[model samples]
Target: MDLHGPLRDASDTILASRAIDGDLVAFEVIAHRHGPLMRVLAANLLGSELESDDVVQEAFISAWRHLGELNDPARIRSWLMRIVSNRALDRIRARRHHDDIDAADRASTGPSTEALVEHRMQLDAVWIALGRLPADQRRCWLLRETAGYSYAEIGETLDIPVSTVRGLLARARATLLLEMEAWR
Candidate 1:
């Protein structure tokens, strides 16, 4: 334990307690612990590492603003994850809204035939399969797989039921599996 470590309780309860008391260090500790996961969620959701930092920053800001309302400190990780996921979702939605018109005119860039890579080809195949899915199914699949969110957590984030989350993921998985079978 770094003697300077924020919050007396390395345990979340005391850490959250100290943070709620306006301890910047305590909150910083929380951010340090969870930042990578938040970034992964954002990066995967937005499909751009460039915007992930901003998304996570927004989540931390929201966390700072709302930490007091949290009922369980032990569950802080999940709470922070939810904020990050929601922030990422907001960014993705805004980006689509802004970029949709230009999208049709965009030309994709890829490695030339001479420079083709097997892993990149596989990734492209997966991306294409995912693109064919309905927007809701794709979003739910990404939320579950990328963020490691439980069905209930995904439901809460997307404002749907757990059963719906399961169905969406199921459909997404089946579609992708069928589409990627050629790669095997």
Candidate 2:
């Protein structure tokens, strides 16, 4: 009679279990509970709220489809986050490989003289250097620096070990410092 009522108050474990049992209301509850945070994580990863919304929606659909495959129902939030991160990463990869000639030409247009202030130039250089970094390194750097995530948090979100996170961060820092030496 009131399928949604009990689901609203259920724990993630309970909801995940029910979702695995094909209860749409339970899955809906899970989506509603974690969607905002998932969107923020996607936005932080992808740098666009609109893209983040699509990534989050895609994640929910994926979760719904594979709820039965979840090994640990209690960790549903982290699982959902991992899905969102992977989806956002996929989008980034797609953007990198799409190769729109017009977009490339437009971006190649050099900045105006007045627009190349010292601060702007430095910022532009940083972005250019960041773009040069490998995708994993860039993701680690952005998660730690822009999102203010702890190394452990970044590792968890990216499904990598803490040691690997540290190593990637070190390499990213070294590369960025070298690339920005001129700005210093």
Candidate 3:
């Protein structure tokens, strides 16, 4: 049977099932079908085209390994999204660590130039402002504004109540507005 035949049948479940049964072609079909959306999502979350590509690749590998664990095959999109999110979060954590090390190295070396010192100070100010936010508020702001997730979707992704997501986002916006006003 043609690949699109099963893909068009009903849900991605059929394609997933075939892929799980060791059908490489079916798996490739599934990957190709969802790859673009996955890339878009990763790019939005990671904010770097290269990092998004790496995240998407990792997500696909993870999905392939755990395909059997997915109980509801029809929910493939959400499943894939979750994988992308987890992978992106991992990348974010790693990048933050790397940045911390770079910052420490720069501090130890002292300011080599006035311009570099000014840039470092600005980055420090921004970090301080962001750090002043409550963790939930910061997370909500990043996921909604940076990652482009809806409130309902953020609630799902974060395992929080939708009302809580709404409140946190409101608080985050208020805090940012205040900070921006102070800057000006």
Candidate 4:
């Protein structure tokens, strides 16, 4: 069977089933269908093109391994997205920890010039403001505002209840608005 040809007719459930049955071609179709969205999600979360690619690859591998465990085949998109989210979260945590270690080292070594330190401090302030947001709110804001995901699509991708997505997005906007007003 030419997997590509069948994929066009196959629903996500069908493709997922075939993939779980060891059909690599079927899995490839699933990957292709979802890859662009995955990249966008990863890039938004990681904030680096190269790191996003790494996160997406890891997510795909994870999906393949856990394919059999998916309860609702039709919900494959959301399941895959959840995997991507988890992977991205892991990457973000590691990056933040690395940054903290570097900052500690830099402090011990004496700070850079006053101008450079001031610029960095401003950047840190923005980052701290963003970091204060709840994870769901942050993810929703990033996916919708930065990644250009629509509400429904984001709800699907994040495996969030649509109402929950709306609430989180609203909260995020409120937070940003307050922060911006303070800056002014």
Candidate 5:
């Protein structure tokens, strides 16, 4: 068990309060505490750890700037993650905007042929099923599954209700189940 990362300590709240009061060290401690998780989440969304670093950095900067607006300091992890998620989504949109659809594959890393083929097929199927979801449902599923956010956290992050989140997840799962039936 990682003893760090929001272990019901008053320290997180204390640090946040101090940071809000203009203490830079407290802010830095907060950053150090939560930065790794934020980076991993961004990397999962953006498909690049390097870009994740930049996005999380931007998130921390934004968090720093808006420290005074934070309502609950104990929930800071979720708030920071919400910032990183938005940043990563923005990056994804920008990348898609700049994508060259006509471009050929530029390179390939060495992988055994059978493994690569199997992985590619599974990924293609999963992505296709995911693509069929409504945008809101898809985002909810990703937030819940990928970030491990509670329904309340996801609702807060996406500005939706917990009931809506539950409904969306149920619909998304039903759709995915039907889509993945052949594989099963």
Candidate 6:
């Protein structure tokens, strides 16, 4: 279809409302807009970029089937992300064993050695800092920063108060900044 048309420029709420009404083109637009990010989330959770496509595909399928059930059309991006994470987790649980290879290494490509090394070190520091955070704080930070979730959305997803989400994110950010500064 003409993806360059006005539909592509529509807001997530508009697109999601259209999709709920069985508008295939609108649904396609939503998929196209969110697919790459969904796949990235899946790959990170699954630790296999190759399998991430299937996980995202399953998420889309599930999303299509349940679009009518979504309470807020504006939150469709987070909704799709939740679906992909669930699907990826399901796949991980289904696997008999796990591979030793890291998905991050596989996903990285074409950077110069120096650039790659520096980037990797920075990423490692962030991960180490993330690891040291309290579980709730880490989760809140990840949902807010990595998943791009709003505080209210993170609160809803975690069944916590919005104030709690804010506090967790604040503490997580402060700790992470301290850790990263130490690393630097």
Strongest candidate by lDDT? 2
Per-candidate TM-scores read 0.59, 0.64, 0.59, 0.66, 0.60, 0.58
Question: Highest TM-score, which number?
Answer: 4
In the range 1-184, model 1's lDDT, one tens digit per residue, is 4546435448766777788889888888788777897797788778789999999999999999998898888778767877887788677656533433234334367444433445546766877787789977987887877667789868766667899989999999999999999999
Window of ten residues with lowest summed lDDT in model 5: 98-107
Worst 10 residues of 6 by lDDT: 96-105
lDDT of each: 0.77, 0.83, 0.75, 0.79, 0.78, 0.81
Query: For model 2, how does the per-residue alpha-carbon lDDT over 60-168 read when each residue is reduced to its tens digit?
Result: 9898888888998988887888788778877876774454444444565755444445555686687789889997898789788866789888888776899999999
Candidate 4 lDDT over 61-169, as tens digits, reads 9998888898887888878877887798778666643444345446756655564556556655656776889878877887787577889888888777889999999
- Tens-place lDDT per residue, model 6, 1-184, is 8999999899999999999999999999999999998887777666689999999999999999999899988888878877887787568656623522344346557555566567667866776787688878876787677567789878876657999998999999888888888656
Instruction: Return model 3's CA RMSD, one decimal.
Output: 6.6
Worst 10 residues of 1 by lDDT: 96-105
User: What tens digits encode model 3's per-residue C-alpha lDDT throughout 59-92?
Assistant: 9899989988877776676677778866886787
Q: Count clashing residue pairs in model 1.
A: 0
What TM-score would candidate 1 get against the native? 0.59
Residue pairs with backbone overlap in model 1: none
lDDT of 6 at 133: 89
Model 4 misplacement above 4 A: 1-3, 100-148, 159-161, 168-184
Ranking of models by lDDT: 2, 6, 4, 5, 1, 3
Model 5 TM-score is 0.60
Q: Model 4 — which ten-residue stretch has the worst lDDT? A: 96-105
lDDT of 5 at 109: 53
